[model samples]
Target: MDSTKCQDHEPSTKLLNPEGPTATIRPIDFTRSPLADDYSSFFAMTIDNLLTPDECARLQAAAGDNWQTLSKGNAFRECQNILVFSPEWASALYDRIVGHLPEEVKALRKGDRLAEIVVGPSHLKASVGARKTVWRIKEANDRLSFLRYQPGHHFKPHCDALYARPGKDERSFLTCQIYLNDAPLSADGKSDGGETRFWTSQVGKRQKPPAMECEPAEEKEAPFLDIKPKMGRALVFQQRMLWHSGQEVKRGEKFTVRLDLMFERHFEKLQPNS
Candidate 1:
């Protein structure tokens, strides 16, 4: 990442999934913010301002209008409703961040230590076998899931499902959650509650990662991390071994888009559920 090279116009590259045109201009000062720390790259990282505040506002407006197609209303995928959409900007956004990503995240690693830690123990390996390797990032997933969390909406810890199709050279390996607004806090400013928290599960554990019925107050022991939900920040992480949940919203409305990063899988004849 050379920060100096950023300019008015950027080289254009084609998108994979839908074969669309690439982004011609950089949206924001992506260079001003770098990865928070080294460990941020291991499983998850909080990327600052991937979407400009204006862009986030526009997307939120769109989500509000198209609420009928919402997904998830259960305890596991709890939320007001997930508004799904496939906007034209999806490709452009993916284009700008592709270069900023570290080489390790740009490619899928079936043997990645992190992936093995979660997948091997969970029933996920039955579907996400180690045989399929990473070819390269294909494009942003076609669908963008916009989730609005109100007063008490939340989700329990669980690993995201793998959408893999090795025969077609398609697989989803990473998730890029774009925060549209800052999560609110209490009047006393003590708890910044609506955060997405991560937890670690050993590789030998059973398929179902620890699913708590409610926030464990006694387990007030800090989690692996509570990723910052700063407005316009994008928290990107690998799908494998990442057990996370959306903590209950304490104050105002919290908005986020759950977007997946599609990857071209190395050809393997025995690929499972895709």
Candidate 2:
């Protein structure tokens, strides 16, 4: 058993198709938003119709039942997922969003640009890997994790974890989650509960998910923002200090693809002709 098999689901050699993004940006600026941030939050954004319902459906179909249960053990993420190495998909998705990102994001990609961002629980240093600053954004890393949350499946409230290749001077700083199917509402336009929720309340600032998988806690007092699952929608956020969860899928199955932003550490911002 190597990095390829023996899992509940095997990784896909070829992946899904990403179309030209055709959506406007909805910026989530923690610094200005009423959303309480123990520390000033960096920029997070969401886009509607980044691809299309048809495109999303095709991708999901292509991944048809190839998912392996990733919820084994006490995993915070309870879903069936498959790993995809799709540089083309990554590139297409990045092209759609890169032009719309805040200039700071592009600058950060140039490396050594953003000042240390000590926000949330994960403090940042003058570095660009796990536990580093997320004030920057770059092209998408070529790995995509396709996730499927059937009824009762969910992800616990926790910060996104960062990763890097063994020796690459690059690391992931942002998470781009693309929802495939719409978690439809009731007949009368009433709401059901499948949402990716962002918890803004300042609580035990644990950087990692629980050591073991456990049941969700009873309802408590904490403010949270719910991003409903709409087909073709893409949610981009910093994987730094923000605490979030995939609210339990009480009804329908929710399909999503998790992509990432890779920050280059060996690069630098070139000054204009000086």
Candidate 3:
């Protein structure tokens, strides 16, 4: 696909911030299957030029002043920093997202179908002679986080927390990530290995998912999905079900913005497992 054409076609709207510079949202012209039969109607979509290069650079610069090392349980190896946008900016962006959502998605939200709402359609139809699918954004976390991954930095394979605990009212359903810049090039003139890797199980109904190491495997029997970070690209997927990780950076640096799309689900009986 022509990056120039995609960039030119992006709709200029007051979605992200009405007062500040406008943000664009464009559909990705790619094909990716849903995770399972149950989620066949649901869509996982990636959009390009969601944030312009200038916007990404500004966010990256803001994060530089306050880079915080992230931890996984007790390990402080996973590194990142949280970015807090102004209240006006946040509210405007959220409202713009709500405005762009398709009617079907709005109906699901109105019905309080938390499960279906979490994995709603993408709303983007396939190109000629291609399969058809729909995509949409049901919700997003109040805050956005900026992460910087330098050489050798990586996040191990793990599923995101399903629920945000009782009384929190917020339950994590999907993860949305936007790349600030392209993957750094190496001495060989090739992009470094900082792709996000997703793992799936071969055996049916296993008690737990298989474990993934800090580094990428040369080969694996189970199904896997690898996504390369590119400037202005955004990826959204099921956070609780997909086992994924941020691969180790081989050179330069990788920056991204991570946001969780959540909903309020009140459990009648909160069990330990629930």
- TM-score, model 3 to reference: 0.62
**Pairs that clash in candidate 1:** 164-274
Across 1-274, the per-residue lDDT of candidate 1 in tens digits comes to 1011111222122222233223222222222323222223345556675666766776666454433322253555446544343445457667755765667566544555644432233322333444554446778875667777777777766667666655675667678888889878778877657888765443344534332122222224433557657787878776765566788787788888777788764534333553
Give residue 42's lDDT in candidate 1 (0 to 100): 46
Give me the runs in candidate 1 sitting further than 4 Å from their true place.
1-41, 68-74, 109-133, 165-167, 202-222, 267-274
C-alpha RMSD for every candidate: 10.8, 5.8, 12.0
Query: Candidate 2: where is the Cα deviation over 4 Å?
Result: 1-21, 31-34, 72-75, 109-115, 118-138, 201-219, 267-274
List, residue by residue over 1-274, the lDDT tens digit for candidate 2.
Answer: 0021213322232333434546778876665544655435455788888866767766676655666877644765677887767666677667776776667655442223232331223323444333333444557987777888887788877666676768865667678898998885767786566798876633354433532223344337766677888888889877765667888787778889888787765423344541
**Model 3: how far is 153 from its true place, Å?**
0.8
For candidate 3, the lDDT comes to 0.54
The digit string of per-residue lDDT tens for model 3 on 1-274 reads 1011111111224223234334444432223433343333433456566666776666556444556666565442466665654343344344534443344443323223433434322212122233222233435664567788988788866655553535763455566787989988888877687887666522244445322113222334545567789886777665534556787888888988777665543223223342
Off by over 4 Å in 3: 1-42, 73-77, 83-89, 95-139, 163-170, 187-189, 201-221, 264-274
Clashing pairs in 2: 74-213
Which candidate ranks first by TM-score, i.e. highest? Answer: 2
